[model samples]
Target: MASFKDFNLSRKVQDAINDMGFEEPSPIQASCIPLVLEGKEVIGQAQTGTGKTAAFGVPIVERAGTDRRVQALVLTPTRELAIQVAGEFRKIAKHKRVRSLPIYGGQSIVHQIRALQQGVQIVIGTPGRVLDHIRRGTLKLNSVQMVVLDEADEMLDMGFIEDIESILKETPDDRQTLLFSATFPSEVRRLSARYMKKPEHVTVNRGEMTVPLTDQVYYKVLERSKLESLCRIVDSEEVSLGIIFCRTKRGVDELVEALLARGYLVDGLHGDLSQAQRDRVMKRFRTSDIELLVATDVAARGIDVDNVTHVINYDLPQDPESYVHRIGRTGRAGKKGLAISLATPREFKLLKQIERETGAKMEAREVPSLADVAERQAEVWRNRIIEAIQGGSLGHFRAILGNVIDEYDPVDVACAALKIASAGELEKREEEDYNFGDTGAKPGMVRFFINVGRNANISPSDLVRTISEEAGVPGQTIGKIDIFDRFTFVEVEQESAPFVYEALRKSRINGSRVNLEPAKPRARR
Candidate 1:
């Protein structure tokens, strides 16, 4: 590992780095910082947590040198990454008087326009939002001397290649271009060939993509039963701090709602959220105020939390690269972490693809049973009791203990006290098995009816997607999506039912208005 000072960065930039407590440069940073400082075009292949932000950010800040105009432009695939990179730029340029602004959607364009008008030296923005400003004549890249594409492969995956090309064409031809991606896919190569001029390539930890300290596992589950299995596993495992990755923004929202209904301390992060909401959610998550963060791939790109104990793939990612990124959220800083995926039989091949691509063996795990949950709860309780006893503060309870022992045998008294102490947890564990109504649904769920079914040419998968998108209820929490001619019945958790109904009540499915309401139970003679 090389020290940050070895790069011979500007004194102010070095001061900022010292303030940030970055003693040593990461592999990517060590390899790329000096090249970037030399104004060389570079292509970096590295994962999210590889400290690439500072690698390019340091050089950009030091070299841009107090330019009031937009001297540097960083393009990111998602608004979250744009904001994150902008924050990093500001931190690295702290000693310097450079102003970096993050321009992305879900924030008022007028706000960004005002910032741009106020003379920002560095601009970090998502491709779409950057192009929007370009079209609006608010962002000018004519003076931009350095451009960076953070997570280049993710931008390619998001169909931002054209937008990137358009944005690049607008920048100064002599500007330095740095492209950083986890994987150098063919698209990335093509992109570099077209835009970059003899870029130096750097690959860090190329052969080892997955973190060694993470315990990777997958559970075989049916599509509809995934929610039940996820809940069971979460309850049994007692995940202290974790992230659940969903494939889409809708999936993220649905999972968040479903988890909330099930009484999990969770929040959602996705493109649909406002910048303020996203910031609030992230702040809470970092502080451990939110135990589980349900997020889409793009939304989670900027998460750098180290205390995350588990990463659950609520929905299997589309590619192996995404799988690596999702699991990389945990097992950070050489700490042991857990990465678990729930895959339907149909999606099992995708899981295999991830294993082959990442060179990681994912152990198969069974869905946690009720007894397993009970055992885990008991173990947790036992640990708490042992810790309390070891603290030697039970003297205050001696009088009560004596009274109980006088009435009953000592063993009986101990057993009674243990039962009383564990009563609430026992009740919660038992409630996990509570089925709702005649639909054989679990507790916290309700069956609902929606018009526009089979005649609308919709399948169960389509219905699940539609409901998830329209109702903001996760597909897993949606139970028994029965499609019939001109009518469909679906079960959603009771806590999310109102949201589902309100969202779908006036929504259209396949060009037909959907009338969604709670299903009326049939009368028995």
Candidate 2:
């Protein structure tokens, strides 16, 4: 429960913590930071997403002098994790003038050697790569003051025991060691006992990590229509905030792109992003500026944001740890949360394994129908109208309603207003018709005129993003758009025109007010 300030860290480390938006220390950090800061050997037992990185990172960065001798070494199991840990060091050590580099395979070892030659205070790398550097004499651990064995269990599981031992022997025996793992199997414990000097044991939420309050479920989806089905579920469930997990970096990218094009506020996290890019994306996600995030498992480590109403597995987890860690993101602090996964028929075996691993049954669900989505939206719209009425600015609309009530039955008028509010979705038929009369439009597209085009310095992307963002329609469905000096003519598909029209009418482009309507032809001219 202690704040970051309670650690009595240097001003630079404190500022860097603030820069990373650490409003407070997490349980792992709270338990481990002080002990690590005291330069004592420590062992931490914590799950992923428990802020373990910063627990060790803050002390390492704070204590690491500006000397360029690689004073700290962190060993991770994968190149992805090495990069991610290095990124966290860069952020935490931002104001401390401590430089860290991630040396891993597949990347240019020559570049890593050059960076190391230039003198970095910290080195984070996979065991294979670190050992390679040591054997090549590119990395010298004589001056390494602290060593971190992150995810020790995973490293041993991957058969890195010999490499880990060789790498550890290269460091000075007096160096402080910090070992962290989700579970301490006998091998991990033995490794710790041999290397660490009377380490203090620190465990958080050891046995009770299951998310009992979370409702676990899965939907059977066709491979081709997975995105469509996900959108339907999103519309029907009305998630306050959600994180969708994909198995690979590419999967995260593709899913994020698809969701954004469908007018969702979304972003992606993967190893492909630079530290700064990842920071920006995460900052936005934390502030709720982006409501939905798509992320790979590694990139989502240490994410402890609250009020995450949903955890969606766009791709199934391959392991028990990944499966449990993903769903545990929601259903925190006694708030009810839901975890859903999309599964093709071939993936049922994987799903059953997850059920057995987590000791929780995943309810099977069918992909929500379009009608179901519409009904959910209408109910949300009615609730919004109720809120507006309670918040009292509704008197302004009362006069407009009064005028309509004079010519029609009050019930009919109210129903008409509700239809308008819902963009006529309630009355949608198999054909899904919208009567955009007398407008100059192609057979399947409606052309609309927009005020302030080139004159307002607007671009087609701006228009597309705005229309799609405001109207909740797919950006890909928008047709051609022509820009003029003072106005623009844009084409939209017939069904989405009304919603797009209404959304734009109340918005602005390039600080200029928007006035949008169906375009008319000048036939006589």
The predictions' CA RMSDs to the true structure, in order, are 10.6, 19.1
lDDT of prediction 1: 0.83
lDDT, residue 359, candidate 2 = 73
- Candidate 2 per-residue lDDT, tens place, 1-525, comes to 658999998898899889888888877888899999888998998655567889899999989987789899999887657877888899998877889999987788899999999999999998999999999999999999999999898788779999999998899988999999887789998999889888999987623445567888888665556788898898889698899999999899889888888789999999888867887898899899999999988788656666899999999989767787788788864578899998754455577777776677889886777788877887888898789878997777887777687888988877877887666546654523346676777777889989888989999999998776566568987999999899998999986776676567656887889899888963655
The per-residue C-alpha lDDT of model 1 at residue 10 equals 83
Model 1 TM-score?
0.71
- Give the per-residue lDDT of model 1 (tens digit) for 1-525: 568878887899999999988889877888898899888999998877667888899998888766579999999887767877888888998999989999988898989899899899999998999999999999998999999999889888889999999999999899999999988889999999999999999887634457667889988765656788898898888588999998888888788888888778999998788778888999999899999999888778768887899999989999888888888888876678999998765566577778887888889887888778778877888898889889996887987687777878987887677888775555544434323355434566788778878888878887778766654456787776778898988888775565566556667777777777677775558
lDDT by candidate, in order shown: 0.83, 0.83
Query: CA shift at 255, candidate 2, in angstroms?
Result: 10
How badly does each model clash, as a count of residue pairs? Answer: 2, 0
Off by over 4 Å in 1: 135-137, 220-225, 236-238, 248-258, 269-283, 333-336, 364-369, 386-423, 427-525
